[model samples]
Target: SNIDFNPVEDEDSSRILFEIKCHFNLVSEKNNDEYKLENRKLRFVYLSKLNDEVTDDKKLLDEIEKFYDNQGYPEDMNTFIEYMPQDSYTNCKILILRFHEFLNLEGEQLRLI
Candidate 1:
C-alpha cells in the first residue's frame, strides 16, 4: 500500500492504494469425482481509501459512477467495484475493485490491463 496526494483535487485528498493478488486451488485427492478442478482462477484486488467525509455508501457509488462517466469504463477487463465499509480499527472509507481478464486470458494480462 502507498499514500499519495491527488494534485487535481483542491482539498487535501491523500489516498492510500492497496493491491492484493492471490490464487486458490479446489482440487481434492481423496474425493475423486468426474469433474476435476483443473483450472485455478487468479484474482486481483485493489483498494483505494477515499476522503474521510465519504461515509455514505450512496455517495461512494456516485463518486465511482462519476469517475466512470468521465474516464469511461474499462474494456479489456471484467471489473467489479464496491465500497468497503469503514472498519472499526481504521475507520477509513475505501473503494474496492476486483479485476479479471476476459476470454480465459492469462493472469499476466490483468497486469497489462
Candidate 2:
C-alpha cells in the first residue's frame, strides 16, 4: 500500500521548521547582555595572564602592548582593548562590578546563554 501526505500540511510544517531554525540562529548569533558581560570577565582574565600584576586596570592598559610585543593578537584590534582600571577588585567585587558595568553599557538588555 502507498501512503500520501497532504501538501498543505507539509508546506505549513516546513515553514514552521524554517522559522524555528532562523530564530535559533538569530539567538545564537547576537551577543546577549549576559554573554557580553561574561566576555568582559574573560577578557580580564586574559589580560591578567599578560600582566605582572593581575589588576584589571593594569592588565587592560598593558594587554595590547604585551600582545603586540608577543605578536599574539592583531595590531588593529588594540584600541578596543585599552581601558585600564586603577585597582584590582576581589573576585566577588569583580563579578558585581562587571554586572554593574554591563548594565550601564547595555541597559536592561536580555542576553541568551
Query: Which number leads on lDDT?
Result: 2
- Candidate 1 per-residue lDDT over residues 1-113, each given as its tens digit: 54563322212111111111112222443142311111112112111333233446656456544443332343323143343333332211323222212223534554454
lDDT, residue 61, model 2: 43
Off by over 4 Å in 2: 1-26, 53-113
Best by TM-score: 1
Q: Assess every candidate by TM-score.
A: 0.27, 0.26
**1-113: candidate 2 lDDT, tens digit per residue:** 53342222334534544454465454542245544344344434333343323346544344434543443354333333333332453443454355346434433242332
Question: Which run of 10 residues does model 1 get worst, by summed lDDT?
Answer: 13-22
CA lDDT of each prediction against the hidden true structure: 0.30, 0.40
- Candidate 1 ranges with C-alpha deviation above 4 Å: 1-47, 51-53, 76-113
Candidate 1 displacement at residue 58 in angstroms: 0.6
Q: What shift in Å separates residue 84 of candidate 2 from its native position after superposition?
A: 15
